[model samples]
Target chain A: MATTLTREQQRQNTPDRPKPGGRPGAVGGHRNWLAGVAGWLWLVVVVVPIYWIVITSFKEQSSYYITNPFAPPAEPTLGNYGMVIEAGFIGYFVNSLIVTLGAVIPAVLVAFMASYAIVRSRTGWFLRSVNSLFLMGLAIPLQATIIPVYLIIIRLHLYDSLLGMILPSIAFAIPLSVLVLSNFIRDVPKELFESMRMDGATEWATLWRLAFPLTRPAVVTVAIYNALTIWNGFLLPLILTQSPEKRTLPLALWAFQGQYSVNVPAILASVVLTTLPILVLYAIGRRQLLSGLTAGFGK
Target chain B: MSPTATPTTARGSRNGGLAWLAVPALVFFVAFGVVPLVGVLALSFTTWDGIGDINVTGLTSWQAVLSDPGLPHALWVTFLVMALSWAVQTPASLLLGVFLANSQRYRAVLAVVYFVPLLLSSAAIAITYKALLDPNFGLGAGLGIDLLVQDWLGVPELAFGVVIFVVSWQFIPFHSLIYQAGVRQIPKSMYEAAELDGAGRVRQFFSITLPQLKYTVITSSTLMVVGSLTFFDLIFVLTEGGPGDTTRVLALDMYKRGFQANLMGPASVIAVILVLVGLVLALILRRLGGRDATHSQMEGA
Candidate 1:
């Protein structure tokens, strides 16, 4: 049955050519089975820690102590989740949402216009300078900038506020975001822009209506990437926000760590809480996730 | 100017004016990005601790960065960690990707499992792993893998291993997807032909699949090289450059000197070197990896 399908697939793949490899009947069945098992084994190893976290999230502290760590809980409970929630997980969750979405929206929008201008504008020198700056940004690690960023925040009186975090996040996000979006926009059909201009659309309208809509994949890709970057970010929020009221998820998680050393279940529980939204987002957009990453970053 | 020429020139100038609209981004970039980068660079020259005023002395920070006992060892350890992690992750991702591409039944499920690590903040992952790797109540003891359960974050070798594992685990699925994309682009007939040739799966993978995956390999490796160099958050959260700075990469060290020590100058120098490495890696990858390297310019959303 497999040999028959292989022959049929070959005929479709290369209609004119003969088979490239050797005989058809006796294949490497044993080796194929081994490879298949090897592949599954690889996946199992990769998935174990993640599975450990999820299962541990449900297990009670006593159960976590007595039972084998690898075993499922004897009886799982929402008690850990309750502890995490009561510890004000939702406030931090909201702070994260505010920071992530707040950064993403402007980052995407401003980057769209900037990318449109950078790609379409006729002037060469300005475009070159802008491009190079963004490119250089690919290397500008946040650790290097944390002090100066801290200074700027206090100087501007934006310190410890969402705006302080949001603004810089947008700034840092631009180089990569503009790079991706502009490349994508550059792929947009020239005729589309010409037609829109002929219809008397303003430059802004042409960008928003014709170019931006077409670049949805790239835009959504940028949004998701920025959201994750902002959400998962530690140092910026750590340095910038001192007030517990304003702290993001990462900061809050750190607070949880210092406060809850022995509460293993609650810590894992918070990890579950903090990690869930993005994981769900990943699940919904997993297909696009890889493409976005490889398309933007991979050679 | 002719009327049409004048209007066109006027529009061009306006576009030029609008181009500076990137200034909001530029201002922040210069302030948050460029200013600090330059500030760090300038700071690296001085002998100042991170606190008070920087005492500007040329090459002092550079001298410290180069001659400091920890600095060179840190660099070596970094390269070792990155190399070993790449060794582990690149092949792992490629094989997993190939398997997922072939099987459809649990692809999404498996992908979610793999990608969950990417979602958590590095601090959170560090925290969770700390709990798991705990010497006492931690699962490491409970599982009887006592040998595997050293003070993973405190000892130099074990700390290095833990850091590498954490970083690699988070990004491996990402690398896998890159491989999967490359695999999908390969025409189906190649696999069938190899099968017909009595090529076993392992043989076929080498002869067919691996060769075709050159672009993905180059891209992912380049990313890994640059990424591992500046990796800070995990190291920062997990070890805080501790068990006596055993896990300090360039970025982590830079953070320690510049921010923690308030020796802005030395930190800046470290930052410059780190950025320089990033640029050099990017340029090298661009040259060696073909036109696809330019595709990264398109990466932002």
Candidate 2:
């Protein structure tokens, strides 16, 4: 199918004959220049706010209001960071870390196993239905399920706890994780599985020794992707947890917004702190993150 | 070869055993995903406060939701946001994606720069924008832009616009990334052929790039629409649907109905509507995009 599309593209893009004096260089130069200008403009649009957040985080409250917002702080201070840390930022950070780890690890593990089953057992009615069920989940927005989730969490007596957030997050992460992982798993050759089986390896051993190692890159991708989502999740924490001490970083940022009121520097300092961990993660695994996210679309 | 034949038969029997590997994930999905979804649908028909005994009030909440003045206004706001996102974000991202895909230098660095907003949490983005859009002490004011000196989040007329702009700003990078991937797939020979045919860049874009991106555009549009429908966190932090509910969306209304108003029935109704709208829109987009894209591939798989 893809080959046909590419062929069609080639045919349509090519004219019946070449034109004289095409001036290809002139056109190419103009387009490249245009691209460069747009790229730089976009860089400014994206970078300035991040820059503003970082610089503003360091400025003293009085200095923030007195100086130009874009200018570097003449008198930088860690006072805002100090204030954020004192306001239980460390607790929020821990809560976020706990939730992300708790949710992402189990979600990816279960998803990997399930995807392996789905890919290998493609002919079973039960497995086909299961695959459809997971795909259907892609359409089930969390907004639609929050009310019932709230009730379920309450019934389980897990409300106002990190587990409340962790459980639903795992469920929500499963569909995409399964989709991406199964796509990766299917690309593995059938010969490997058959050979492993012929060697008297049980399915359990095959999964561990064969599929698991083969799909490690995909495992990492799903892990990082799900971790990013769970780490940044706000709605689950907001609706599920009530205690300030249980707040995650996103919720903590919201709390800071209100508590600081007009203390913009303090609020932004929390923003910078809240975003820093994820930024570092992104910097490290950006290629994997991008590939994992766009993997579903590309296929 | 003889050993392989015997084990192949053994593997057939072990298939059911291996199916048990999916049990843990299925249990989680059934507990948190399937149960709540079914419960929400059932709860939508009943008039029950969170703690009280359940009483079935058939269509009462749905009627209330349909008749509520606030509901229509909220839907309107959500639709406006969706339209703005489609109109502004889609084209901008496509252009940027095309530019980035074509560039040979600084491609990786530029792509990362554009993706910064997406990597950050929505709450952080909202807070950053909230401070940045402050009329007096913001970057706009700092840059001496008199027009941006107004209270962006406070003015009723401009609040939703600012919310949409910020939302688009955060998401454009995401859509652009998708477009960039799509653009990268088109063979370079196609572009070279176009250039050989005396087709200029603009002509090549219209003829080759746009046509090839049809599926991607549909995919991104569907995502943007569904996302805009349920959007809450950023708007919640930035404006709280305020300056008089100008930015209020259905998700926020649903949140308020359940949490603040203690009207679980109406909230469930709204929740059902949001899901239905999302599903219907996704289906429609799939149909419109020619059904040959990822959806079919997923099903075929």
Judged by DockQ, which candidate is best?
A: 2
DockQ of 2: 0.34
DockQ of each: 0.33, 0.34
Please provide, for model 2 over B129-225, each residue's C-alpha lDDT reduced to its tens digit, 9 standing for 90 to 100.
Answer: 8888888777677778898788999998789888888888888887887776667666566777887898876788788888877777877887788
Cα error, residue B104 of model 2, in Å, equals: 2.7
Over 4 Å off, model 2? A1-34, A293-296, B1-12, B140-145, B292-301
Which candidate wins on lDDT? 2
Alpha-carbon lDDT, every model: 0.73, 0.80
Q: Among all windows of ten consecutive residues in candidate 1 chain A, which has the lowest summed lDDT?
A: A22-31
Candidate 1: what lDDT? 0.73
Candidate 2 chain B weakest lDDT stretch, 10 residues: B292-301
- What is candidate 2's CA lDDT for residue B87? 94
Q: Which CAPRI quality tier does the interface of model 2 achieve? A: acceptable
Highest TM-score scorer: 2
